[model samples]
Target chain A: MNTIRLAVDGVNKIYAGQATRVVAVEDASAAFAEGSVTAIMGPSGSGKTTLLSILGLILKPSNGRVTLMGRDVTDLDEARLPELRRQHIGFIFQSFNLFSALSALENVLVALQLKKVARPEAEAAARSALSRVGLEQRMRFYPRDLSGGEKQRVSIARALATNAPIILADEPTANLDSHTGLAIIDLLAELAREQGRTVVVVTHDTRMQEHVDHTLRMEDGRVYEN
Target chain B: MTYPVPMARRNLFHERVRLAITLVGIAFSVVLILVQMGVYLGMMNNTSSIIDHTEADLWVTARNNSNFDFSLPFPEHRENTAKGVEDVLWVKKFILVWSLMKLDGGGSENVEIVGFDPETGIGGPWEMVAGDPRDVKYPKGVIVDESSFAKLGVAKVGDDREIYGSRVRVVGICRGAKRITTAPILFTSYKTAQELNPWMAGKTVFLLVKTAPGADVAEVQQRLRAVMNLEDVYTQADFAWATKKYWTLSTGIGLGFGFTILMAIFVGAVIVSQTIYSATIEHLREFGTLKALGAENRTVYGIILQQALLSGLMGYAIGLAINLVISDLYRRTGQLVVQPWQLFAADLVVTLATCVAASLISVRRAMQVDPMEVFRA
Candidate 1:
């Protein structure tokens, strides 16, 4: 039994208003073990992103117990979650959420700074991570200076530099063409295997299915019957 | 993802157009705060300097008078009555009046005339640029501030000029002389001034004195106030405050600056708030994406805060530089001067206000973003 990197137990999330509670995640349970790539595949209006949000600690679940390496972190206060994410989790967004003014290395360096690494060491690690994604030549260039595929690559390096035990990516390949999407999926698979970390991707793109070690598909805020 | 400081800086300089627009807005406020506050503080300092340059502690004037430097025709014996007060070190008689001075082309303009005792030279002149301050100790000798001479076309040291129908030779230039009641003051011995205006012998303007250190000025003031029975008595600092209160608070200077300073703060707050709000609005989708990808609420909060902090600090720095340069330009024109403490206070207020405004923007927008929007169309 390898260490369970992330485990979500029957998470139920609802968007509540003055009059009603709209259920977004309904009793979804999931486990992403260490050294595995997990995908939550779904169509539009499906609960994949909501489940991912609950798993990522961005949204509080109405009923759930989240365990990282078998520690019940459900009732953990919101303030402690940032430090938790920095230590054990890496996040990648489809929009390449890198700050536009910072160079590629700086974008990754920012993540490292969050990880609480010293300045020089963070910079050196950022450079190596960019080289890992084959963007060594693009380190000094800003996001505006990068192309679509190159930007995604820098973001991937940022995830790598974070060096978290788990990487949570939301449609990391959405902005790229098929070739670039394939490269990113393959890169994520390589990163999981090489870094001995868990990767949880929330996406509808079936190109990720083959690279994923396990897939928990969702539909209409529930796990559809297989 | 986690820059503590530079995150805000990146957003500020990212778009030069926005940067320039934001800076212009901030600069208006900076200039406004600086000039208004400077004038407010400058008025106080000027009054203090006027007192410091004079060798007077106990001032005696005609009963119920407000101005210390203006001509108050008090009985000359009052100077001795003040000197007779316990612990009084020295007594010197002085006079302040305005008499028509003859300029070129037989033209005449009113010039402030200050007369001091030539022996003790109490309330003579200070800060000589071309010559000595002690040069004015000679009878019928004058020390004119450089600015006054600049207004008078082409005059130098050692020039003889008619002041109140008497010829007085210029001893030296008082380098940074300014207008008191909108007229330049010329320094001379009380004898020369009394000689020029014979009415002065009966009416002396000031009685200058010194005290031992640790002297209870309040008790001494009460004793003198009871004995002298003349104008209001005040300590040096109290006099400075009175002059500021008289010029700035009593006059329209305070009210004039109030509106402008408020407008400056409003401009600063509105521009900074709008910039931060604009950046927040622009990044909603990206924020959602970050949120969906396991970024905590604080993580998203940090991004917005970083942007706000960056813009505020940058704009403030740029605005301070501009204010300093503008202050120098004002100095060159010889109208205003800026003090370090005023500048520091303005900066502190502006930066703190900007940060608070930025925090408000971050809280408003960060709470509204839905994490699932990252995956939505």
Candidate 2:
């Protein structure tokens, strides 16, 4: 009976071209409950990433209503969307998009800073998040100096430091090997079950099905529950 | 919150080679601007060197006199008229006429004869390296500055030279007296000047007047202007400025310098804009990531602008230091290159403005980045 934290009803995204129109996401409808992990799996060009983008408030859905905490946010002002995203949702990208100029701890601190958090408090939170990811000894190491697994952990710590209620990860472990990818999946699951935070992941790895609470499949720009 | 990441600083220094190239470009622009401006100022100062060094409070000259260097001679009675003014302390007849100096090798060069009353030393050389200003009172005696040694072909004191078919001895050598036309200046007495140039027998080019202590110089200038109705009357400062303006505006020198300065700024802006734009393109993914993390456009622009400003400040410092060393070298060679504090302030403003304008291109490119690009494999 966990309350639904994020839900989209009949959401559609269309990219209009001069010569033709492409439907990136069509009639996608789903609800992600609180303190549960949901996985959306699809092949290449299956619209999973497009759906994640819409849910992350990055792209506007052409026709649908997006509800966050029972409040309809489909028609919010464009300027207010960034603040809404910063305050409520955190995103983890597939390729581990950490700033190359910053160190591991600074990468996490930047997310908190974007949310207008104070310096000492943000530092403490960033350190705690890095420690939770078992990277306490490598806080000062840059991305180029760290391995692929370590870089992904830093990115996760960046998402965690913001203290948002919902986390959306897009292919978070696609670059890691089999062993490291499984470890990342387990880490996302633990974050959801233990901390009671909603976690939505768009990934193609079949191994993700065994750990998530619910699974959905996407094909040809359409979504279906599995 | 003090920007705990120092993202701008880190990004600017991330690539050492690119940073070095950018700094060099900025520094070159700054140096070019300062050097051109300094030289222009120095040349303007030289145009009024005689008027500036003299202790005159007012000058009475012919109505058609264009500048101090090119003046038409008025009657000597104007000296008496200036003396009749109430606040006038004393008046001395002055002569400035171009003549030819017959070199020992039979190659004659242009020279300017500055004739003043040797007894009062009013319009004579102010800085002397050898002998005395009063030495010009001797028959056919002339004092020349050390700066004109090579041009006039006279090395030291007592060297002989001919002026307009008249024999004259160089009795004294002065320093720091310069002419805008690169002609050697010869300081002599009124009698010697008239003897050297027979056409200047009963005419004087200027009447140098000094005001009494505690007297208003403006009042004396007004009274002299009223008394000498047919001639032009100018205070010392106004006359000096007139000479400087004649050289700066009447001649095309100012326009030439201005064009050079503008070109330097344009070149500098291009260098900075290309460098910053390339850097932004290289970090396109990082910029997209920041946008996805909900950073506002202002935050991203602030980082880029900060990088530009840092580059400007560092480059200005290095360029100013180099200019100082070059200015000292020029001074040693007896060339004036003026760098006042106001010039430094203006240079700083120009540098920062150039840097900011250059950053706008990068900012535009950064703002168009799509946050969703970070999700691409």
Candidate 3:
């Protein structure tokens, strides 16, 4: 009820392969509000990933309109989209995707620098984000030097550093053990329930639905209620 | 890193196979530049050594000829004009002629006959390899450079050698002096040189003028040139350099070898670019994640550039050391010597440019990576 953090209206995405066209997402539409958690749940090929991508602004829709922060953006040019994405949203991937060479703390600072934070201040901010992830001591360690849980925690720190109103997570737990994955879900849920942030998670696992406020099931590029 | 280093650094310590291949490429390329450049420096040094050994403070040649080798003879008595100059200490007649020396072994080699007046400063050879430089005289005698001994296929000090119509004794083999033309040098007495090449008449190729220490050589040369007909005079250093420049300019040495060095730099730069581009491709996902996490496109690109520069610098170090070794080895036999400053400037330029250039394509690809790709599975 606070405000729509993200809204998609009849967004269609097509993948043009050499021999045939595969509709990755068909007329997908959903709205995410601030201070809430939404989940797109489905098995493989359900178009959940595609829907998440369209929301993340990483993938362009073939048809229909998508809006973010109340601006209709489905047809926005690619060149201008990255700046908007960088400024307004944060993305969390299934693999953590942390740079192995950089320390957990350095990974966050790099993000701050990209945001054009002044150098000395960026370092302090990066440390603050790492400490928020309960990783003050672990910040000095590299991704290769960290456990899977630790790496994921560092990734969350990077996302949190973005200070975006919304975070879009794609398959955020497909790689983790149950307890570690649950910890991540609890973290995201806590951010929404207590920190006044919007969270949208895409996953095939029904086990994660309880952590989200609303659940939408997708199958063959179509969305339905469970 | 605040700025991303070059992407190619992944292979810096990560991929042994790739590093080995790159190191090999770098080492061999360096050797190519080194050897080709050695030959170039060798030619310059050869001219310097001969001119240095002559000890002539000034060279008075025929008026329009820049090179003594192309000189038309002036009067042998041009010695009088040089003596009249304020700083001139002594003046000696010197003549040069082309001839063939019949080796003790049944073969013949081309030789340049240089006539020096033994009584004055112009005729003595350097520390003799087998005998003395001045043991021979004008009527019929010669001093051979040591390398010329083997090159001429000749041996035995005091062996008789043939000049134009006269036979001369090979009294000594001078130790160090060599020539640009790669033929042997045979120093004979001034009178004998004129005797062998009768066309030389009373004219000498150059009148070797020595100045009293602290004498103004430039002033003496200026005065001598004005006093003599059909002659130009140069300080010893200028004359020697001019002799070298004669060969360098006339033979296209600078352009030909300059191209080879330039190509080496191009190859180094090309390798850097290709390697960094490939490395960037390998790190695409990593970069995407970085960008997604709030890394600017420029920071991502910067990392790759630093990597390219580091690689280029390493390659240059390896190459320069290799060339140094080659230069050191050859200098003993007086082949070619490479100077440190020359290699330093070249290597610095090569690797710096290589590092910067190699990062270009990789940086572009890095900046182009879509952060959203990380969400695509």
Q: Going through the candidates in order, what is chain B's TM-score? A: 0.87, 0.94, 0.85
- The digit string of per-residue lDDT tens for model 1 on B1-377 reads 33332655676677778767776777677777876777666655655565667766665556655555453687887777787888777777778777877886687778877777666656766676766656666667787877686545555787888866778788777765466455666777787778778776677776666765677777777888888764666666666566667776666877887888887888788877777677677667766655543456777777777666666666677777887887788778766474677576766667657656755866687688765665454
Per-residue CA lDDT of model 1 for A1-226, tens digit only, reads 6678788878888888999988888888878888999888889778777777777777778997888767888998877776777778787777777777778887788777666688777877888999999999988898888998999898888878877888888888888899989999999999889878899998878989999988888876887533
User: lDDT of candidate 1?
Assistant: 0.74
| Tens-digit lDDT track of model 2 for B1-377 | 24577899999888888888888888898998998899888888888878888888888889967689999998987788788889889998999999998888888999889998899887889999998999998889999987787787655778778887788988999976788777888899987898899999999999999999999999888888888998999988899988888887888988899998999899889988999999989888888888778887788899899999999998899889988888788788878787788989999999999999999999999988876788987
Q: Pick the candidate with the highest TM-score.
A: 2
TM-score of chain A of each: 0.96, 0.98, 0.96
Show model 2 residue runs off by greater than 4 Å. B1-3, B84-89, B211-229
Worst 10 residues of 2 chain B by lDDT: B1-10
Task: Give the total clashing residue pairs for model 3.
Answer: 10
Candidate 1: segments with Cα more than 4 A from true spot: A1-4, A19-21, A118-128, A190-196, B1-6, B31-50, B69-71, B102-107, B127-143, B150-175, B198-201, B212-218, B283-325, B334-360, B367-369, B373-377
**lDDT of the candidates, in the order given:** 0.74, 0.89, 0.75
Error of 1 at B164 (Å): 6.7
lDDT of prediction 3? 0.75
- Model-by-model DockQ, in order: 0.31, 0.73, 0.28
lDDT for each residue of candidate 3 in B136-224, tens digit (9 for 90 to 100): 65348788887675487655676777765468877777766677677888887888777777888787888888888998878777778
Shift of residue A206 alpha carbon in model 2, Å:
1.3
Model 3 RMSD, rounded to 1 decimal: 5.7
